[model samples]
Target: MKRCILEGTRIWQGDPEAKDTYVDFKGSFRTEGTGRVFLRISADSNYTVWVNGQVAGFSGCADYPDFRRFDRIELTKFCREENELRITVWHYGIQTQTYLSADGFLLFDIYEGTNLLLKSDRHILSRINPFYRNGYCKSISPQLGCSFFYDATKSETPYQESVEQGPGLAHWREQKPLRLKAPVKAKITPSDKGYFIDLGKETVGFFFLEADSPEEQLLTVFYSERLIGGKVNGRPGWLDFSLEYKAKKGENRYLNTFRRIAGRYLFIECPKGLNIRYAGVCPTDYPLVETHRKFADPLVQKIYDTSVYTLRCCLHEHYEDCPGREQALYAMDSRNQMLCGYFAFRGSAYQRSNLVLISKGLRPDGLLSICFPAGMDYPIPFFSLVYVMQVYEYLSYTKDQSLLPIVRGTLDTIMKTFRSRIEENGLIASFEYPFWNFYEWTDLSHNASQIGRTKEDKTPKQYDLSLNCMYIYVADMYDKMTGEHTETEGMKKAIKEHFFLADKGIYRIDTLHDRYSQLSNSLALLAGLGDRELAKNILTDPDMIPVSLSMTTFLYDGLLKTDSGYRDFILENIKTKYKKMLDAGTTTFWENEDSILDSKAVESLCHGWSALPAYYFHILEA
Candidate 1:
């Protein structure tokens, strides 16, 4: 058996007057057998995992009282017995006041055939690959250590940098640029009452308590890299100070300026024997272990545990970025519990209203993060469906008939705004604004063309399969709920005759174009428009299968609806393509397979749609 343990490790030491206080430990591991692995990790705050050198999973939170995040990795193909794992961990904020006894260990069970051979300590032991601290730490899940670049420069370019307040800092400026000197000296002074740090920024990073208490400790940076300083105004993280600098910029001028201003930028600890420990240096590649621990029962438990998270995620209650009740619910949980309200607002009021109700049950500004794709600006046929679906979901999930007044009022606002924009053809026209106005059609990369507004307009009149089908589904669902079918039947008939090219065995945006999209196929079947048998057959077809299997939502749904053969096909495909997806190293599913886009480029990483698999698992079992 292999194992590594660290006990009574203090990551934070609170003193009334201290500059620094916090500690963190991290490690990495790889598996050596094609079996299952169970990981049990407990820490002060939370941890994240990267498989095959990409972020694969993460867990933990003080917000949700019952949130105990443990990971069980299935080392199949993408992750070989010799795979790589990376873990980064953040310690609890000093204000947490939880008894500190930090521990990190790994136990791996090696197997040969049905019999188990050995289980190594989470850390790898080898002659050439010595059991040093650095490399193994790189391969572990939930790593510790974040990057800090103030005046870090290479090749004469100053990185573009900004210092802004975190969750709080109403008084602080947004993306405030700060000039600094090289080797910035960060020193702290600790007193019995609290602590203080003179970092030489316009804002002094310090804390003071009125009397003796752990929460009174000053200079409490939960993670030093993220906070120059912050306040605890009622909520846990009220005030915030952070430095965000781009390393890719020319000359790194901003970093150089900050470095030049500060004399010494190295990690500093204050007097009174500060509770601080060097989490680890920045930009340093840590060591890693390849083998993993396995357990038959643990794997089952993991599935059940993940299902609970999926439910929480579907309600947009857990993850990185949950949406509001009034927004569209994407199929996944992008937000952690903080915004555990809703998903994407591509187009669906049922999804949005469910998400918004979930949010209202939690926070006041729950719906702010709910983004309506091409709302107000880019008008598209599918976008309005988002509004309709959210209303239905909100009504159903909450079962609150009293809110009918609010719901009706919001619907009126939507109808009044969009009704005027509908073209003579009864289809909502694409926004005719600058810079690719329509969200769905315009943003797609497959040689996108415009959808004209007027009947006489010249742009391709190709109607979208997914959009039209969703229109039918939402319109029908809405009419049943509200006693007004309106023009729903007309919409459904038009879609069936025009886009439903029967002879081709696949629906098309335009029968003449013969375009076949994975989205069109999935939505067509899901909306109950296409022939079930033909749709099932085409889904199993090798060429279409790859695209359909790219996202787990489709696969999970297909597997539940189809027989053993179809399920096996998707299972094998997922197993085969798992590594390629993780090797791409994305925290969330991407718009495409290639995920190495510029970080500065605006893209959705925690998009709700991609997380549908998490939700699909529950629906499958149900």
Candidate 2:
């Protein structure tokens, strides 16, 4: 019911380490309606909210980056008549003071129509207190000035993490070793002929030039409105931009398989001729980021990350392009490069090889494999092979020696982790658990087959053919690095015996009975897991084309290794699939060959795994 809602609170920063603390503020509001209520809250990071007796909402222990405002939540679900909103704040800290305000932490206004129905210090409550806060209280405000009571030094402090927000970027959560880059010196100056603005590439977010000078610079960024597009001299600004399409001076540019990556922004004053020319270039090969405000907004990234997690949770999809499909795919190489570096430094080799895209946390425990049916829940060593391959490929392309220490450390870590997982039968288990389809299969359109489950079968799940082959490839790479044949020969022999079928081109899975899957067939070639000749035949197989298309050009890669002629054919196919996806209005990669438009239907959006095509496209071009 398109009900208008503007909700948030303003509060003073309090020394969280004080007890019996109170903050009082006065805000006057008058409203009339049959069912009118204001959801008010002082703060709710791991706390609860109450407006009179009705419950508002409960929050988990969160690492909120700021102390200026309260959560702006929709309270339409909790609106009540005769609004006497009272908030009870609880603190688990032994030496912290919680702040309470009458205008709330911010002013929240609610209306049923033009009639201002309910106005309160806060808007929206958890309706129920979170059980996390050990203690509770009643009646905290309206004193306006002195609103706290607690031993400022001995009060328990609310727990917090350092992932806070910024102006044109997300919160700077020191990514282990690398904190967010320092703000580039952006200076705009006026020249004699025209205004020369030197942002010095502080172009982290959306920037538009309104006119030649600050007098005509109509720049105002509002958080509540997601509308980021603006006008330059009363004309469509960003939409009117046309680029020369190349990296600017003094910028590092990266070319991924499908996109280019560069860090520069240019805002040109429109010329007053027949057509005003505004030019800028985004080096990535994927879609240009639509909103710099969003990219720079930590809240947006948090929300986007939530969407990515939701998709990962629903289906075990781990490809970067699934959620922010194009965006993730474009950033895959850079992101993984960083991830590989981070894990390498952390001494977690188990994750070094897993070409994990976006998952839960940046730790070994959260890495997932690229192979489908592997899903986001499972992490296998094969994906590590892919990751290492890409890392080497990027090193070769960029010739950046800065990554050497990381690469070497990662190889060492992967070897150690894989050694522990390898069974006596020369096979490494996919995850901590044996293969028992962790979750039901979700299809391309985000629909479930709804297959009923049976008892967990433990018949020593036949050695997965694709996985074993990838092990051979990675083990071989490891041998190259260490100058010793460490487990490569054994893995290779097992792959050939168990995975290679005389009749079918490749073994889909390790079953005594031969069954071929497009995935198993393609990965066999991609991973260099099977004989070169057979891998080529499988790629051109008529039955495999749909599956191959579904797999995108990720498999086109193996064809380059096997048969050079497949290059043109593969590129053409990539174009065709790109067009098809565009036709389907698909912004990201699909789980199957359908349903790419339903945004709510979850699939891994930041899947660094599936974004291989973007990287592959770059590698092939190179």
Candidate 3:
């Protein structure tokens, strides 16, 4: 009988400050007979698995230090009695939007027919990966962490020992392994500086390349969702979508499991001598199959399929706002995704898991982080209130009352924070310094988008219409969930007392400004501060400030709440709006309608929030 341990041993690179650290581990164990083999593994950041010399599986769920999740990988097909295992783990030691910095470690467990054969410890051979440069930490975006520089010319180092670090603060739990798909490749086309590889559509994936070079060929890969001036504009906006790799002489095979590129085009800048055999990206999707339902109208059905595809692209470990640039989870952005996901997909686990992940992002000030597990402290007050609504809707749809108790404290904290901020006018004032008071991309919330990253707040404090309306909405949800009394009536009264313009049949932006926006008006109607007549008026007002693609969900919801027959209006509106994207041959929807003609061309083409037609087409059949 073989003595075995079920849990894997945790190993670290021995230094926490070794940011952008990548380690390669390999070990071998002999089995007496052929049996089912499995590997249970977890890591601080990300991990990839290989059996013998063939690729097997890759991905560690995005987790907080308090709750580190592991993946269970089956390797029966790739293994033999005399077997070798290789696992490469890249730990981002610094905090970013989706990833939180934590103890950098890797734990491995191998099992054969329930008999544990191997586990990670100092006994397992490991060394710092020589191919991937360790310290050259260049960022693709502040939101999406770091870019990689791989040098194939660099020789592998001698196997060394990995220091044993005990299981960390996070409780260990097994998770469903990531779904790996076949790599999507493109024929290389000659361009200005190099060759452009277009995959025909946006794909959230890992870079894979198999090529041969006459001599040492240094290649710079510039990738993007769309082309500017017929060239791949890698750094379209605040993003630096580029990677550098040194190809050694002869054949070179690389499957970059580190940085996940979300784009249709990859432009490789290399000399003429390099011969490309295969070049593309392998998509890693959240393992959830879609239930297809085509509409009567072919255009509507086409839009529905495209919207569903957009939602699929954004869902990896969690619900990312977009797969292109900012692969982070924000409450406001995810609220749209969740509502649409309720109709598009069958399972509720992905939505529930995302709600839990966002719950772990609470700050000391009682607001959720701008994004989940984000290192920075730029909390959006409007977005935080949306969390309560999201939680209610999630629970309401699933009837999963169990989740409320888990997230009840978060709900309480968020409500209290906003309630306490109510000023003499009976409305919550705009959040002070450090807290971004952004409502939407439009000038509705004073166009806070102009203020990029700053610690100072130049905007004055006034009772903002959107914030107060959201507070009322959240307070109502809080009251219903907790069965506790809230000052929601007073808050609603104050909102009407200050911002409502009865004659104009709309709400003002704030006390400081006379502006009115579709977002603010929609929120007011949804919160029951207004009635069906108000909804009809808001829909008709040509002068009301229009909403962006992100906030259109609320607009549609408000309209439906007052009148179900308004579904026809929503169906036509959606078909009209999303048809433009269909006409442009978009595989996924755009970030906003303005992105279609905008010269900047830096907008994300596959935004999850913009995929609301998937939800509408399901409920309000066109």
- What lDDT tens digits, residue by residue, belong to model 2 across residues 1-622? 0122333322222443333233222222343444444332323223334444444433211122232222333345554444444343433232111112121122334455445544432323222122112222211111101111121112233422111111211111111110112233444433332323333221212222112221212111111000113211211221112111112122212111111111222333322211112222211111111111122434333333332322221111112232221122212233333332232122322122222222211225323332211112223344455554555544444455455554565566656666676777667544424212221122221112212222352334445555555556556656654465665566656566666776756664554446555555555665566557666667555644235333443356556667787767765665555455445433333443343333332232223333223433434451
TM-score of candidate 1 to 2 decimals: 0.41
TM-score of 3: 0.95
Candidate 1 lDDT, 1-622, residue by residue in tens: 1123311112221221221112222333455564555433333334444457544433332121221222233334335555554444433322211111232222223233334433333132211101112111111011111112222222332212111111110111011111111222445555453333444321111111112122211122221211223421111122112222222222212211100011001222212233432211111010111112222444323433332332232221122221111113221222211121222122233333333332221112111112221111212334345556655655665565554554554444444444454445544433332212232311231223442234344554344555555555566556656776446455556656666656667665433455565555655565665555655645554544234222344334434454444555544343344335444433233333332242322222223343333332223321
Q: Which sections of candidate 1 miss by over 4 Å?
A: 1-381, 412-431, 434-461, 510-512, 540-608
User: How close is each model in CA RMSD to the real structure?
Assistant: 21.3, 20.5, 3.0
- Give all TM-scores, in the order shown: 0.41, 0.42, 0.95
- From the highest TM-score down, the ranking of the candidates is 3, 2, 1
Q: Write the residue-wise lDDT of candidate 3 on 1-622 in tens digits.
A: 1122336667865475588888888889777565788777778778888888877788754777766666668888887768888888888887777777887788878888878888888888888888898978798888788899999999868988878888522333324567778888686887656778999888888888899888898899988888787788888667799998899999999888767889898999987556788888888887776787867789988999998899889877778888877788889878888888888778787788788778878888999988987875578888888899999998889998888877888888998887777777677777776778888778756456534745553666577888888787777787888898887788888888898888887888889888788888888988888888888777778887888887888899888888898888888888889988888878899888868576766778889889888887887766
Model 3: colliding residue pairs: none
Q: Kindly indicate the candidate among 1 and 2 with the higher TM-score.
A: 2
What's the lDDT for all of these models? 0.33, 0.34, 0.81
Output the better candidate (1/2) by lDDT: 2
Cα misplacement distance, residue 596 of candidate 3 (Å):
3.2
